[model samples]
Target: MASDGSPSRDTPEKQKRKKKQKQRVEDDEEGRSSDGAEVRLDDDDDDDADEEKRLEKFAEEDIQRLTAAGHAALQSGDNHAAVKHFRSAYSYASKLGTRRVSKTCALNLGAAYVEAGNAEKGLRVLQRQGSSGRVADLQFNLGTALEALADAMEFEEAVRSLLRAGESYSSSGNPTEAALALRDAGKVMLQCGRDSSEEILNVLTNSLELSMRITHSETRGRILNTLGLLFSQMSLSSEAVECFQQALPLLSGNTQTLAVVLQNLGATHNTLGEFQKALSYHKEAAQLYGSLGRRAAQGRCFSNLGFALMELAEIEEARESYTHSLLAFKDSVCEALGAIRLQMREPEKAVVHFQEALGLLSRCQDVSSSVQERLVNKLSEALQHKLILQQRKAVAQRRHSQRLPGAAMRRPDVLIGRREMMNSGGNTHDRNQVSTEFHSEEPEKEDYSNTLPEANRNLNNTHDETDTGQQVISSQPENGPGEPSVECGKQMNGTLPLVSGTVTPPPGRHKATPPQRTLKSRFCTVM
Candidate 1:
């Protein structure tokens, strides 16, 4: 009778009560029907004549007060007042309320609360009405509120709210709102990438479609930019270029927006290995930003140009660009970061960048828990990279230190390491099996031949034995290509380091450089 050894509460009376509760829940979810509030002509109870007449008189008076005052208060931006009067509406409507008035009043009241900076209260009121199509709008409001609270507290529930909003918005003939929600969701999905590119293209595509249809040119431009950004994520530079072009013209009077677009387009091109195009875009962006007095944007463009130059193997030019960007965006966290990273491609530099970003965000009075957490993660990644680099550096230094004394007496900077030999040694490769069919004996061409230039001839004739292992003479330039006819200057295999730099001790053994501070910024700019 009782699963917990308590008296059974499963009687018919209990069942009826439970059923009523369930129905109540369903009703609360679906909102109250105006039909129940309406007076039915079929229910003409003669005993209620006196009461009905009195009720009609009171309701008529109440409706007048509710209607006049509520409208006036709403116009005056007194949302709380508006809601108070709107709540009295049910008492005033003798024949019950119309669906349009009831639903619209509730929605408008909730919206007023939101506009008045009472999101939590608004959400509460909105959620009181179960499964109305307005849930989507409520969800959007909830997401914004949660994002605002993210700095002070964790709003992990924002995702569920966002999903609900998306569903409702999609179902309510407002595809644009749904698309926007999907765009937000895609950001989360893309960050989910581990090995391959994240599968956020579907969400982005939907956003792109809806955004394109928006009537506002500025908003339309932003959506087009979103497409460009999505394409950039996939390293599809050409497609990104097309999107950017469409957006740039639309965003044309807004200097700051235009500069940012150019900068993004420039960065995308660089990533795609299009240095020439990247250069032109960056230069234009930098100039525009400079004219607009937007130092941060100007500096960012400069840094992007440096990265492009670095890819082209123009080390000196890259360094100059980075230095300029750092100076221009001196107050900017990313600028300092760009400088540090350009110096050595060090993760420590990344840490500095993140820290700077965090600091800047804080200074702007926008410190949030999410920003702090992201910065912390970036710092951790930087530290790990720094540790790995330190380990590598220590190993190289140790080897160099051991050879310091013999430097004058032996070859310079020779690499020393114990190597393992697999199976029977003579560097055997099972030549016949690893190659295409070779003539059994048509005066078999020697593997080592005159085809290789004379520069390697001397190297082939020499060999050295070391305690570590048998050292073979390397018959090629250490930093040059192995191709026999390669231009010595060209270093055919591109084996040499792109930049020329002598390893020097770090500024200080335990210098505390700025840590990277990854703050959430302009994430919705493109979206």
Candidate 2:
């Protein structure tokens, strides 16, 4: 009876169907071999086939699910979860004898492992799948894994893999990926500290060509910026300038990247000796950095700006720029400010700044000893310069006090009389020649210390000089102890020749040159 009180429905129709089914099962079980053992029938064979198909369908579904989950995790930056999921998917796909699906799964798994920083495991998994051939994705992931595992010795292999991957990607019509792969190859070469060899140039050129075809402006800009940095490092200033300039407009929407491009342009122009262009670009970069609230970067920009300003002989503006830099970050700017003071012949002030820089540097971590030694040398030079200036000033003061007031009033007439005497010989000698001859005939015992005050005045008034006549102070290597000093009388285009060592004027000459100025190399830091 039914539980709901309905009439029972197990009639003859159901009984007949059950009997037929039982008969068929018994017949299938009745089949036997020669040893009288039961054998399977067609009906049982059909059932077993359906069950296998069902299990296979379930496995395929699981693979699809896991693969989707892996991709999602990878995109979300959950590398470990992506690796686990992809690994399971790859295992299932492998057992299912689906060669194409399994290859895809393997590539995904390998990429996930690489992103997780397990490059060794990624490499093993990728290699285990056999030859990748012309498969772009497979080749790219393989290259990435190889590069991640590369050391100094294996860099060549990594570069080769990346180049191959780039070619494969290009052939597959993926210009963006191709450009990225080539750029990676270039970076690997740079990391190995390779010279600007033909191979490196070719790789970077190919990357630039590929990047040109990309529609994404920021990506292209970034690639150009990277190439510019590489060229700059290799001393290819012209090429670097071109690359940075091209990247500038493309990166405008991104302030940080735009600032970097501007800064790089400024540095490259500075290297090319285009101070005007450098000044403009550095000013723009500094402004951008200020807007971004990046004090360190802003300070560096201001420092570079000060360098350009100094080159333009804008002494006051340069000093102001250095002051801004010092306010932004106190350490590195101290050294630069000290260099400026030294150039201005304010050695006392230079000494103080250099000492402060040295003290700050000592407190910094991971600072190289050579840097500190350089600072020490600069400090020593500043102190020596200060002492020399003081001694010269004292001697000039004493001689000034000893001289009669009427002697200064009569000096110009005495010089004119000597020039007239020289001209009386009917040889129209210039004033310079007359002065030279007059001094040559003077008594050898006569003291030439009378010209010291004039020379001192020239040194003090150097800041008023024009760009064409101004001295450039840098941080370049000083002359050796035995090197001959530059002659101050050898002027070019109304500009005093650069002095490479101590200045020593000829007797009775009032003209003097400023102290030797060094040339420091400036480099732009890539962010």
Give the candidate number with the greatest TM-score: 2
lDDT of 2 by residue, 45-130 (tens): 78999998998898889988898887666556577997899889889988988777777778778777877889888878877777
User: Alpha carbon lDDT of residue 75, candidate 1?
Assistant: 54
Candidate 2 displacement at residue 476 in angstroms: 30
Which residue runs of candidate 2 sit more than 4 Å off their true CA positions? 1-54, 193-196, 330-527
Error of 1 at 237 (Å): 5.7
Which candidate gets the maximum lDDT versus the true structure? 2
Model 1 TM-score (2 dp):
0.42
Q: What lDDT does the true structure give each of the candidates? A: 0.50, 0.63
lDDT of 1 by residue, 288-336 (tens): 7556544444555677777777778888988887766655444344633
Cand. 1 Cα-lDDT: 0.50
Taking all chains together, the TM-score of candidate 2 against the true structure is: 0.54
Look at candidate 2 and tell me the lDDT of residue 462: 24
Model 2 poorest 10 in a row by lDDT: 518-527
Task: Quantify how close model 2 is to the true structure by its C-alpha RMSD in Å.
Answer: 28.0
